[model samples]
Target: MRTKVAIIGAGPSGLLLGQLLHTFGVDNIILERQTPDYVLGRIRAGLLEEGTVSLLDQVGAGARLHQEGLVHHGVELAFGGARHRIDMHAATGKTVTIYGQTEVTLDLMNARKAAGLTSVYSASDVKPHDFDTDHPRVTYVKDGVSHEIACDFIAGCDGFHGVSRASVPASAITSYERVYPFGWLGILSETPPVSPELIYNNHERGFALCTMRSSHRSRYYVQCPLDDHVDQWSDDRFWDELKRRLDQKAADELVTGPSIEKSIAPLRSFVAEPMRFGRMFLAGDASHIVPPTGAKGLNLAASDVHYLSQALREYYDEKSSAGLDGYSARALARVWKAVRFSWWMTSMLHKFPDEGEFAARIQIAELDYLVSSKAASTSLSENYVGLPF
Candidate 1:
């Protein structure tokens, strides 16, 4: 088979890119290592930056999102036994939509199916060949049969553990990574959130966040040791701990319920330099990873997709390689900024095992200053709502 672009992975990035290309009259096919159900079942960040929402609108996938997604002008930061609100809209003239990534994937997948875009799910041994040459091809196996797709370009949107990045030679890629000492033990429950807006808390016990997918479904997280297991935490104990760490008002309003989903995600910041290689380009988690503190993971992916989609559009329409040639530098420039913001938020809110009491006091001071200083709060709000694409 021959197409203009051969996309790897059926995740949000890959699916979103494919849809955008299809809308531009660019022929492409998506390959996934798992079933559609498996991809949709994966829970991920729900905060949608303004740019991301606009991208969905461009692809005609915003009908469900705009109807179901929550719009928030601000988020609360709880520290020193108080809850402080940062007006993101007032600070930066922007707002965020709380729509789960799973829903975004479903929207794109349904849109792709309706448009008759080809996507190969459960594709095994997916590999890109001859990307350095003018003609490139992707080979994979489906149903025990081998197949090849000859394309002008390849999009490596597969993610961190996907074959896209790993396929590149180590000498050509420079990776920078930092694994935090703690992990987030999060739970999803069918209960109302403690607050209407998301609350990011810095408490003596640990860092905790109160967020939600909707009015009735809450997602909560607390910092825990790396060795902590899900079996070690009970529903009651988790609620009790969450309440203890929150302010009096938030704690009193908190509702407890059985956890529908629970998991421990380790915090880390990772970035791979030069997202483009030959005719293949990496986007989303394939090139970088940020801690969940600032909720930048999915947003970063969207920005990368936006850049890449635009680049490919230019290449095909104007017959210009300018955008494609500049994809790496353009994407990485924004990627690094988000990496810094997430790292700063994680460092300020979470406890460090080695820092002792001095660091704890310093963290509290920083949080205090952030709430008191309009400049500092606006900076935080700007990054939270997302930097301009």
Candidate 2:
């Protein structure tokens, strides 16, 4: 098979890249190891910053997004049973939308399908070959038959394990990573959100977040000890712990329902230097990862694809590879910014016995300082709300 670009992984990044190329009158084939249903069903990041929403709109992929998304203007910070609101819109003049990553994937998949595009699924033998040559090839199995896909360029949007990144020479990619001490235990409940706005609570027990998936459903998370067995906790125990951490008052309204879903999300930070390797380029989880604290994983992936598509559109015509040349450095600039923010938030809210009480006090002091000062708050809010593209 042949196309202008052979994209690995049909997740958000790959799908969006195809749509972007189509707009430039460039045709591309997206290959996936998983079926469309599985790709659209993965539970992942749900927040979209202004730039993310704007990109979707420009690509004509925002119809359902704009209609079904919940635009949140602000979020609440709760401590000592007192709630403080950060006016994200008033502070940054922009708002974020709450739409799950799976929803975005589904949206892009449906849109691309309607356009008569087919993304190969259940494909085996998905591996990178001939990437050092002018023509890169993606070998895979489809419909019980082996196949070879060759293209002028390859995009690795297949997450951390995708083949695109593996094609690169090991000496060329510089990687950095840090693993945290705890994870977030999240659950989706049928009850309405306990708070109208999303709430971030730093309670004595741990950190808890209360957000909504929709009007009738809520998404909540609480920090768990690194080795805590989630299967051991009863529903009552979960609620009691959340209440203690957030300092919820008895009089406050609370939602009651069976937890429909539960899972642990390990905290970690990762970035691969020089995101581009010859004719093959890495994007999305294939290149970087940030803890869920900052809601950056999805948007970060979008940024990479956005740059990749623009480069392809320009380079295809003029034979100029300026954008491709600067791909890694340019994307890394933003990636590092998110890296710092995610690490900082994770440190500030999580417990570390090795740090001693003095260190813990300093963390609280930092939060207090941000809340009390515009300069500090702006820095936090800007990153928390979002940075300009």
TM-score to native of every candidate shown: 0.99, 0.96
Candidate 2: list runs displaced more than 4 Å: 249-251
lDDT of 1 by residue, 1-389 (tens): 99999999999999999989988889999999999999999989999999999999999999999999999999998898998999999999999999999999999999999999899999999999988889999999999999999999999999999998998999999999999999999999999877879999998899999999998999999999999999999989899999999999999989999999999999999999989999999999999999999999999999999999999999999999999999999999999999999999999999888788999999999999998999999999999999999
Per-prediction CA RMSD (Å): 0.7, 1.5
What is the RMSD, in Å, between candidate 2 and the native fold over all Cα?
Answer: 1.5
Best by lDDT: 1
Number of colliding residue pairs in each model: 0, 0
Error of 1 at 346 (Å): 0.4
For model 1, name the residue pairs that clash: none
Give the worst 10-residue stretch by lDDT in candidate 1.
Answer: 351-360
